[model samples]
Target: MIEVENLTLRFGGLVAVNDLSLVVRPRTIHALIGPNGAGKSTTFNCISRLYRPTSGRIRVLGRDVSGLRPQDLAPLGVARTFQNLELFGGLSVLENVLIGAHVHCGGGLRERLAARPPAVIGHVEHLLERVGLAEFRHAQASALDFGRQKMLELARALAIRPRILLLDEPAAGLRNREIGALDRLLNELVERDGLTVLLVEHVMQLVMAISHRVTVMNFGARIAEGTPAEVRRDPLVVEAYLGQEAAHA
Candidate 1:
């Protein structure tokens, strides 16, 4: 559903992404894995139109989006969650999700909340339940535990009803149980809802267990691309990111 070709982004002398190219097929989960400074997030920024690339093209849903503004992406069915939590601390979980829904719901925040349109309300409630935060919907975002907060962010992203979801490290700060829950939720999204996902995550088990394809990167460029099993056994991927122990595991 997304294609990036010969993409490069330079910050003066620092080349954050260099000639990177990859494809995310429709209705599947793709993982982008690499070391800390491997430019995964930088590539995401370019795809999301948060950063303009120095060269090359980005196509989403078959249209070249290289010149579109960030706001332009949502209308084109794109949504994402950040590596760090971006929830509004003071807003209730419901309110935060409502903000995301505003793109589709079309009303002032107070109007939407007070009227609680059946279509919008039902969608938001379903997302809350999907993320296991239905009970916390009325609570302040800051009041939830970290794992719940992550789930809340996921709900907000889904509020847009995006065709393609770009998740930046969704498994970064969670207990094993929480990670397991996330794994199941992601699979369900792709299988049941037909949502295409491109996630950048460091959790090897999560990536290997769910991803249809894996692309390995280092120093801002792709070093390997294949299925999860194929990537795990690549010698360069083992040395550069996964390590020998992880490769063996």
Candidate 2:
């Protein structure tokens, strides 16, 4: 559903991403994995329009998204969560997720803030239940533990009702139990809800277990792209993670 072609991003003399290209198919989980400074996040930023690419193009469902603004992505059925939590500390969990519903709401900010229609409230409540945060709807967002807070962010992103979701390191700081739950949740999102996911995660077990396809990057370019097993056995991918001896072994 998303295609990036020969994308390059340069910061003066340094290149953050060099002619990187990849594809995310519909109704599947696709992973972008690399070591630090490998440009996985930079590629995401470019697709999300947070960074303007120095060269090449990005297409979402055949529409050129290279020039589309961040706000414009929502209406095109794109939603994402950051590597770091981006939630309103003072707001209730319900209130925070409700903000995502604004993407579908009509009228000025005042009108939206005045009184939410019953449907919006119901939708937010349902999302809370789905994300296992039903009881915490009225709780202060900052009061939740780290794992729950991450789930809250996911709920808020889903509130956008997106067709494609981009998740940046959604498993970074979670406990093993929480990570397993996350794995199941992501599976349901694709298998049951028909959502497409493009994730950048360092957790290899989670990435290999859940992703239908994986792209490995190094030095700002794609080093390998294939199914999890294929990538795992690739000499270059092995070399990138291990040393030369491991690759040749």
Candidate 3:
């Protein structure tokens, strides 16, 4: 569903992503794993149009999106969560998600709310429920705990009804139980909802347990790409990212 061909990005003298290439198949969980400074987030920024590549191409659902603006992505069935929380701290949980739904609901927010109240409100409520935030809908986003805040961001992304989801470190700062919940939710999204996922994560347990394919990166380039088991056995992946103990585990 997503393809990166010979993608390169340079920040002055430093090269963040160096001719990296990978493909994420439809309705599957494809993971991008690497150590710090591996350019995983930079590659995401390029795909999401937050950063223009120095060279190469990015295609989403068969269209070249290299030149598209970040706002343009949501309308084309794309939505992403940041590696860090990007929540509107001052907004209510429900209100934050409603903003994401604006892509689907055209016209001014007041007008849409007045005309198609049921559809818009129902959809946002459903998304909140899906992410276990139904009870917190009226709460301020900044008032929620860390894990709940993460889930709220996921809900907001889902409000766009994206076919492809790019999640950067969704497992970071989450408790084991919350991680388990995230695992189930992600599987449900792909299996039942037919969503495609491109995940960049450092949480090995979550990545290994859930991903259908894994691409390992080091020094801003791909070193290995395979099934989780195959990647675990790859010498380059072990040496660069997973290490000997992790490879054995």
Q: Please estimate how well model 3 matches the true structure, expressed as its whole-model Cα lDDT.
A: 0.93
Residue by residue across 1-249, what tens digits does model 2's lDDT show?
999999999999999999988889999999999888899998889989999999998999789997789989999899999998999889889888888787867665556555588988898899999989999999999999999999999999999889999999999999999999999999999999999999999888799889999999998999999998788888888878634553344
The positional error of residue 197 in candidate 3, measured at the CA in angstroms, is: 0.3
TM-score of 3: 0.96
Segments of candidate 2 deviating more than 4 angstroms: 107-113, 242-249
**TM-score, one value per model:** 0.97, 0.94, 0.96
Best candidate according to TM-score: 1
Q: What Cα-based lDDT does every candidate model obtain?
A: 0.93, 0.90, 0.93
For model 3, residues 96-146, the per-residue Cα lDDT tens digits are 888778876777766444444678789999999889999999999999999
- Output the lDDT of residue 181, model 1: 98
The stretch of ten residues in a row with the least summed lDDT in candidate 2 is: 240-249
| Count of steric clashes across candidates, in order | 0, 0, 0
Model 1: colliding residue pairs: none
| Candidate 1: tens digits of C-alpha lDDT, residues 101-133 | 877776677765566677888899999999999
Q: What is the total number of backbone clashes in candidate 3?
A: 0
lDDT (0-100) at residue 165 of candidate 2? 98
